[model samples]
Target: MKKFDILALGELNVDLLLNRIAGFPEVGKEIFAQDMTLTLGSSTAIFAANAATLGARVSFVGMIGKDSFGEVVRSTLEQRHVDTSNLIEVDNAATGLTAILNYDNDRANVTYPGAMSLMGVKDIRPEIIREAKHVHVSSIFLQETLHKEIFEIVRMVKDCGATLSMDVQFDPEEKWEFDYRKILPLVDVFMPNEQELMAITRKATVEEAVDVILPYANVTVVKMGTRGSLVISGGKRFHMPAMLNKSVVDAIGAGDSFDAGFISAYVRGKDLAECQRLGNLAGAVNTTAAGGTGAFSSIEAVKEAAQRYFGQTIEL
Candidate 1:
């Protein structure tokens, strides 16, 4: 029996947020931040937490060090009702962390990859793959081992009779070395932001990028922040407009939240149009709070935020 509706095979990290900085850092200069908040970080974690809040049976499979940061990652996921039984704790490295310097409407991030970069295809067990109805992986470039064995990882998950989704987040090195022809055909849903899509396809525009991948893509969803999203499958296309919020906060995990909403609806057999709309709504809601999981505290809170902020009722 499948114990989980979704298995988020992604990175686990902590966020060290620094707000109201004196000024941008210079090579030889020093500046101090006025505030600090250390919490759970990583797009996959946000997606899993929000999916759990949306009433999905979610579990996380990732590697972390047997340290305090790892403890933080485990406890926080459990608090979000995400099963962490599949988490792997390695003693060779520490948990990953991203130090975020929050500015007015933008931020600078420096990530310490740590154990998050260590998860490999060999680390994922077949029994755990059979426990989930679907699998979602994000931040391809960040995970060194996984990136090296991408095809094998996807093949393993697919062979287990579970569907697969992947959000190939920005390639930090700008190499954009992913082979779309091989990867796209295996992925049930291919999620990416506008920039990532363009980069991966080596195209200058979104249309150009879509044209290149259309041949191999099964279900492609392009997340255009503040501009909504695009849904493409077979020969049909849906352009989802953004649900703008009046009082906007930082957009830390908006895209991940969008993935959560989209996948949550998708797993429940919702049509692509509804999934795209819910994805847009969830992304909008994410910007109304401090961080990715803040606006998605619980199912009740999510419904309240949707009703009160965007005036939409969450079907879940």
Candidate 2:
């Protein structure tokens, strides 16, 4: 048996979220925010934490700087029980940070890559990959400089007999342009949101997008917020409706939680339908709080939500 159940690789950051007023600022004009809060982000970190909370032995592999933000990132991971021994601390670079602007249930973000850009394939140890049941990669853009090295790392993990999962994060800055078709075959599971699937495949419909990408992986999950998610594999598709909730406070990290939920259910050899339900429950519950990792529900809490909202069983 593998020593770890899952290993997440990619960027880590501190998010400074500002809630802007309802109206947009005019060109060359300034607008003030009503309130704000600082939170932990970085997609990989959030997912790894959620996975650990859901009962997976997980490790985080990424780079941070020797700064206060880096300390917060490490502290947050430690609090969530995620293994951070593999997290590299860069002496010269500053930790990654982001400023998020939120308004009327919508949000925009401005990010500074910082030390996250410095992570390379050499940072990954072969022995670590050999000890994991599953490996996940996130935030492809921030580590564009190390794409070739990342590909090599992914190949090595697969060669070592671990299942590979990938989460795609689109960067408007186009710091890196990913060829999904080229990378998909190397991954056992390809997870992306509806918009991301469309953008990557250049397809007009979700079904079309799935058809184009399905050949690349054994399983593909496209997360559609509110409406739920679509899971497809071997020419079969399952649509899981979103779990209805009363109120939503913050939507950050919901997708990462979904990834954790799905992988948790999946590693246990549950049916695809049940996995989607668990994933949906995890995502819906995450919106009820602030911050990414902070919002994730416990395994029992998620099971209760699934039973209460969807009248479904979350198979262990």
Candidate 3:
């Protein structure tokens, strides 16, 4: 049997969130915030943690520095039950971090791409890829080396006979220089938010973008905030409504949580529809907590939150 059900291969970082700020800062001035929080960050880490909570045997394969932030990343993943044996630690660079300034419904972020940008194809091991039945890759743009070598990484997974899912998180550069036609065929599932999909495909609408990628994409899921998620596979399409959360603490890692739910169900042979439902439910649960992983401490916690907030029962 495979050692892990899912292997998360992507960026790892810490988030320093400053909330309730007085106002936007001017060029030479400093502003103070009323609240602050330091926590593990990165969409891939969120996915791996939540999937492990959902009862998937998850392992993480990412690069971090031999620093305090790296310890935070490793310990947090361990606390969440994700295997960290594959973590690459290097002394040359410091761990990456993001400073987020939150204001009401929106937020601004500045990131330091440290060691995460240094990991590339040379770091990935075929034996590690072969140990997982499925592999998940996210936040391509944030990692410079991984962004340039994504095709090689995906091909490696496929060559290991492992199914792969990719979440092309927002490209900070906005260049969106992805070769979708060549890459999508290797990706079993393509997960991207609506805006990301539109931006990547250079299409004005989600429909147009979907059309552009449908031919090459095997299974594509478009996450539309509040509205719902759109799924397209084998020439069929369906829209799954969001499990609306009226009192949202934050939407920090909702998309990653959705990915965790969907992929967790997927590796267990759940149908597409069920996977979508779990994704929506997991996303809703994410909003009920403070950060991306606050609500997902355990499977029972997720189940309780799902039932209490959405009145839905989650099997996983």
Candidate 4:
């Protein structure tokens, strides 16, 4: 058996969230009326933290600067019990960071790739992959220089007999025009939100988009936000409803938390329906707080919520 349940590789950063007031400010005009909060973010970091909190022995592999932000990331992961032994510190590059502005549930984010982009395929250690039951790749485009190397690493994980998963983070600046045709076949599970799926397949409907991308992987899960998620595998489709919550504070990183929940359920050999249910619970729980990972819940809490709302145990 593998020593670790999941090994996550990708970006890590601190997020500064700014709440912008309604009405855009006039060009060249200064307007100050709103609020802000500093938070931790980065797709891979959040997912790994959630997975570790959910009782998966997870390891995070990525690069960070030898700066205060890097220290914060390290401390946050340690507090969450995520393995950071494989994390590398880059000497010259600064740590990655993002500034997000939100208004009435909508948001605009400005990101700095920094040291996160410095992660290379050479940075991955084979021994880590060998010990992990599953390998997850997040924010592939941020490290544009490492696309081929990341694909190679995924292939190596397959060769080592571990399941592989990937989160497609679409950046308009860095368009995802890669040959997913070649890389998708190597993945066991492929996860993307509705918008990302639409962009990748150029399809109008979610079902159509799934049909177009299904051939590339054994299983495809498309997160549909409030409507929950759609899971397709072996030509069958299953829909899970989102857990109802009174209020939602933040939606960022909810998908990553869903990924962690789904993968954790998968590693436990849960059925497809159960996986989606747990995923929805995880996503819903995350929105109860203000930041990306602020509301990440434990496996016990997730299960209790599942039983309370869905009238089902988390068991497969």
Candidate 5:
């Protein structure tokens, strides 16, 4: 058996969340935030942690700095039951960080890419890829080297005979430069939220975006918050409504939580429809808590929240 069920690749950071902000910030002005929280951040890390919590054997392969922030990132992953043996530490740059100004349902973020931007194709070893049944790559734009070398990385993962999943999170520069044709063919599962999909595909709507990539993509799951998710596979389309959480703490990391739930179920050989259901359930559970991983403390915790909040039973 492979040593790990999933290997999360690319990007690692810490999130400094400022909740209940007075208003959006302006030049030469500062606003007050009622509450603050510093927690593990980055889309990939959230996926790894929550997948592990769902009982998947998850490991992380990313870059961090030799600093306190990196310590927090490492220790937190360990505490969440994710393997960290592949984390690379660099003394030249600090660990990555994002300052989030959180409002009611959404937030604005400013990130310092830091060491995460330094990891490239050379840092990833083929043997390491072979150790996992699947590999997940996220936040390509957040890491400069990873973005430049993504094609190479995806080919390597396929060569290692591991299934690949990708979540192309928001582009900080807003210039979505990914060539979905070249990359999606190598990716077994492609996960992107609605806005991100439109941005990357330059399509007017979610349907248009899916059409542009359907020829190359294997399975594409589009995350539409509260409205639910859309799944496309084998030229078939299915839409699943969200398990609405009326009282939301925050929407931070909800997409990553969905990815975690979907992938965890995927490696266990669940059907695509079931994977989408678990993903929707996990995403709803995410809003019930403060951070991306807060609601997924354990498998039991996730199942409990799934039943209590959404009135749906989750096998994981």
Candidate 6:
């Protein structure tokens, strides 16, 4: 038997969130913030943690440093019941981190790639790939080495006889230079938000972007925030409306949560619509708590949020 159902091959980082700031940052001015929090962060970390919470046998393969921040990342994923056996620690680089300045609903972020950027396809071994039935990779743009060797990374998973999923989280540089025609055909699931879909495809509208990818894409899932998600498979479209939380706390990791929900179900052989429903609920639940993982402490917690808020039970 495989050691895990899902292997999260992605970036790891810590988040330093500053809330209730006195004023916006200026050229060289000092600012004070009333609230501060330090927690595990990164789209991949959120997906791995929440997937484990939803009862998936999940493992993480990412790079960290020999610093205290790295310890926090390791300990946090372990606390979430995510296997960290494949996490690589390097002596030269510090762990990645993002400083988030929060306003009411939106936030400004400054990221330090650090050690995460150093991990490339060479860091992943065939043995590790064989240990999982599915491999998930995210935040392609943030890691320079991974970005440069993405085609090889996806191909490696396929050659190892494992399915692959990718969430190309926003490209900060706005270059959107990924070779989708060559890459999408190899990916089992292509998960991207609406804006990301347009940006990556170099199209002005979602419809046009989807058209661009249709020929080469397999199963494409588009995250349309607030409106829920749209799934395309075998040229058929499935739309799931958002089950909005009555009282939303924050939306820090909702999309990642969506990925967690969908993949958790997908690996268990759930249908497209069922996967989309759970994904929507997971995303809405994520917003009911602080950060990306607050609402997903346990499977019971996730199910409770689904029932209490959306009046739906998450069987998976």
**TM-score of each model, paired residue for residue:** 0.97, 0.89, 0.97, 0.89, 0.94, 0.97
Q: Give candidate 1's whole-model lDDT.
A: 0.93
For candidate 3, report its TM-score: 0.97
lDDT of 5 by residue, 193-218 (tens): 99999999999999899999999999
TM-score of 5: 0.94
Model 6 per-residue lDDT tens digits across residues 170-256:
999999889999999999999999999999888999889999999999999999989999999998888888997767887889999
Worst 10 residues of 3 by lDDT: 307-316
Per-residue alpha-carbon lDDT of model 2 for 1-316, expressed as tens digits?
A: 8888888988988989788565775789888888988767788888898888888888888889999999999988988889988888999789999988877767777888889887777777888888888888887766755565656767887888988888877766643456766677888888889878877787888888888887776789999988999888787888888886667777778899888888877776778877787788888867766666655546676566556655766556
Q: Predicted candidate 1: what Cα RMSD to the true structure?
A: 1.3
lDDT of 1 by residue, 1-316 (tens): 6899999998999999999999898998889999999899999999999999999999999999999999999999999999999999999999999999989878999999999889999999999999999999999998999998999999999999999999989778889889999988999999999999999999999999999999999999999998899999986888978988878877878999999999999998899999898999999989988889999987888888888998999886
Model 5: residue 239 alpha-carbon error in angstroms: 0.7
**Model 3 C-alpha lDDT per residue in residues 156-267, reported as the tens digit of each score:** 9999999999999999999998999999999999999999999999999999999999989999999998998999998888998898998889888999999999999999
Off by over 4 Å in 3: 27-31
Clash count of each predicted structure: 0, 0, 0, 0, 0, 0
Give the Å shift of residue 98 in candidate 5: 1.4
How many angstroms is residue 17 displaced in model 1 relative to the true structure, after the best TM-score fit? 1.4
RMSD of 5: 1.9
Tens digit per residue, CA lDDT, model 4, 27-62? 788766478776578888889988887888998888
**Residue 288 lDDT, candidate 4, scale 0-100:** 72
Measured on C-alpha atoms, candidate 4 has an lDDT of 0.81
Q: Which ten residues in a row have the lowest lDDT in candidate 6?
A: 244-253
Q: What are the Cα lDDT values of the candidates?
A: 0.93, 0.81, 0.94, 0.81, 0.93, 0.93
